[model samples]
Target: MKNIPKVTALCLSIVFISLSSISNAQQRYTDYDPIADFYNRFWSVPLERLAIGKLEKIMLPNLKPKAEILDLMCGTGHIAATLHKKGFRMTGLDGSAKMLEFAKKKIPNMKTILADARYFTTSKKFDAVICMSDGLNHIMKEEGLTKAFTQVYKALKSGGQFVFDMNWEERYIKGWNLRGLRVEYDNSEGIISSSYNKNTRIGSIKFWLYYPIDKAKNTWKRKAWELTQYCYTPQQIKKALQTAGFQTIKAYEANQDLGDARNAGRAYYVCKK
Candidate 1:
């Protein structure tokens, strides 16, 4: 009876610690479905079109006509669509089913795979594999990024090309420190809040989306989700590519030839096996 208070306090402390662990885990994990479902509605507009168009023009000269291509992390199929129109056989792969649904609607008869880039595999190898638009930044772990690179290497045919782009650490440190960005479309709108942790080098963005109940009504539906991206330096990217068995690698800054200098947050990489 004399020791009852001490035992009770220890048990309470354990419970409190467990609860804190669970909360932290929840904060670290994010579900991508909401962002996927509303992806095109909010993103890949005129600017996205222009970027994809420019990228296609720059890469087209390097690829054989009608080459089989795999667009890894093929969000909303923007790049795949562009390449397909230019006569490349494209298969889009992404972890999000909802995003694939939108992509299918945009490009009918397109093949898509629902799998994480970290562990994705395919029996059908590709002539060229692309993971663009800073898709590698979403891995959140260096090991996971390496896994994705290795998987992509395995999925490419001999002497095949891998082209992708990544946002430099500079972008996260300076650009992603945003607060309450308001974005609007025809009948939908949203506010985006973003922050970057200097120590972790992880950038997080929270989206709050509003949809009109009716065109004339004041009522709206709301949805929210959080996304996180890890930052990598140019040297880190090159090392990953080399470790994944790429024979040669060339990285081009956005302003060099491919994209507009105004959008110089990212650099493009071309590697060959």
Candidate 2:
């Protein structure tokens, strides 16, 4: 073959390096999945305070939940605990053992099962299935999206609905160009933020952990942790749901009624099987 131009070769080399680093960055580590940490601290912590109100006003109000509610991808059982307190029968399902451990500690009375979101079952079916907080965007492939919807369809009662949301790529593109930010929860741990890489379309948040070497000493310590996930568009999500046997489909923007708005960047789907 002919020799490649230097400029073109350099660009190709940069892409290869980026891809290789992404692979190693996501490589699973010692009983610690970065996603689990994110679930445990970042979103879960805030949801613990906000999910109850959102569910009551946004999700559960429109319809009644006749039976139990399945919180698929329920990190730390944050929503489950609220439902449990409200006297609504609720159960949590998640694939991350690390997260489930923290969830158990938080909601000792609530029941939790370990299973992948794409294929999970329980002894009893649910009247409503809610997988919120951009859990829909985690389906890195078209097939995974269909499988998840199909499985949720089988698990829900005929009149029940599968509700979930995803952030738009526009949000990622608009946000990622900015440099990383720092938000320290304490000396030990804090959040460092960065928006999407336009070329790669990957957004990330790095968590830093600093420890005290000694109470009497002047110095402390530091550790680095990172989490990343792919982003998806509304069109891709809608097509996947339609193909997955959902008969009635409603898509909405963030903080809007569960009605169709294809152009909306942040999307929520209320799918009836």
Candidate 3:
């Protein structure tokens, strides 16, 4: 009896440790699978417009016609499809398979890769690399940000440009944290909640969505997910880019540079390798 009790305790401890490890792993990466459809349908358009406008001004002019471009962390493929229409060779890379499914559907001939920004490798170099819509913010650690920048640097040819956008404290506070919580669509409804920790410089958004499952029976299903982002100052981002071997860097406030009020608190960067 005494031995049985000790054995049970040890087994329970082992199970607890295993579960903790799994949870930590999950927390390290945000899984977009659950909300990929929603993002594709609703969230991709405005973000795509912002990225395309900035790219036209800062990236396209510097590249030759039909130049190769890598859309890093490309979600839903909206921007890639737009660029492809403009005669650019577009390659989309994203960590979420579900997100890439939409992209592939949009551009059947486009090359899409499912890989993490921090550790992706490419067989061919690109003339320009873009990580837009605050993609780099998803890399929650400074070391990871540096790793992603290094990967991007390696993926680009000499003299190639790397352009990206990021949100600072202003965006999180005024945009996400203070925005209305409820969103409604024809078939589904969502509630959004967000928080930012100044000390950790991390922001998180939790989404809860409800939709019809069995319309005849008046049944509904609910899905929930949370996403976390880290806010790095321009100085910190510039340091990371420099460490990754980018020499010339220019930063632009999107609201001032792009002339869009919706881009308030967003900053764009253009770097040359």
Candidate 4:
């Protein structure tokens, strides 16, 4: 790593130790399998809109109609599908097999990959790479975050840009520190509860999905998953990007540069490699 600023160096060191703690916490948890099946029905439309808006802001200055782009941690390919409609060549990657399955079904011509963002790589480079909707936060540790950053840097062609967002503490205090959040579909209902710990800067969401299997008999399918996210200060994020070799970096309020992202409760970063 190049010589980082003192404050940034300190932040990087903090992330080094935090990774172990985060890993321990992770071992106690299990992945949510059904969330992938539920993703499109619940979150795809709004999240895809915000992501497309942000990408337009970054790409409008000089965009190639068929620019090769990678969507990291792409859940259900909502954003990629939107970009594809605009004539961009899009690839969607996510760790969830079910999510990618749905994405492939939805976009038969689009390419999808099943991989973890922290260690994902490819010989094929891209014009731009995007990790949005608090996808970076899902890494749960600074070191893994840095690795993801490095991987993105290496995967981009010269002058390629990386765009992503992370949740702010303010977002956690207001959004995650809540309970009894409920979503109901015609045959499926889900109860979501969220909590955040200031000391650990860890936010967790527990989702209980109930789906009717038999209408008259009232038989239901119950599935659950626990998700965790870590909060990082702007300094930490900048430092990590810098360490990953991003030369030009810009930070924007979720909606300042992209209207659709206003009050999105996350900070967006655009970095050039």
Using TM-score as the measure, which candidate wins?
3
lDDT of 1 by residue, 1-273 (tens): 111111111111111111001123223212445566556765656535655655565566778889999999887887688789889999998876777887898789888987778677799999999887777788766777787899999999998888888888666766787787777644667677888888987788787666665434445566666677878878788778778888689887776656466556677788888
Q: Report clashes for each candidate as comma-separated counts.
A: 0, 3, 0, 0
Better of 3 and 4 by TM-score: 3
> What lDDT score belongs to each candidate, Candidate 1 first?
0.72, 0.62, 0.80, 0.74
Model 1 scores a C-alpha lDDT of 0.72
What is the lDDT for 120 in model 3? 84
- Best first by TM-score, ranked: 3, 4, 1, 2
lDDT-superior candidate, 3 or 4? 3
TM-scores of all candidate predictions against the true structure: 0.79, 0.73, 0.84, 0.82
Quickly count the clashes in candidate 1. Answer: 0
Candidate 4 lDDT over residue span 1-273, tens digit each: 222112211111111122223223223111333466667777888888876776677654566779998999888888888888888898998876778887888789988876777767798999999888887897777887899899999999999888888888877887785666777755567677889999999988777656555646645666566678898888889888989998699887765555534355677788888
- TM-score between model 4 and native: 0.82
> Quick one: how many clashes does candidate 3 have?
0
- Sort the candidates on lDDT, descending order: 3, 4, 1, 2
lDDT of predicted model 4: 0.74
Error of 1 at 160 (Å): 0.9
Better by TM-score, candidate 3 or 2: 3
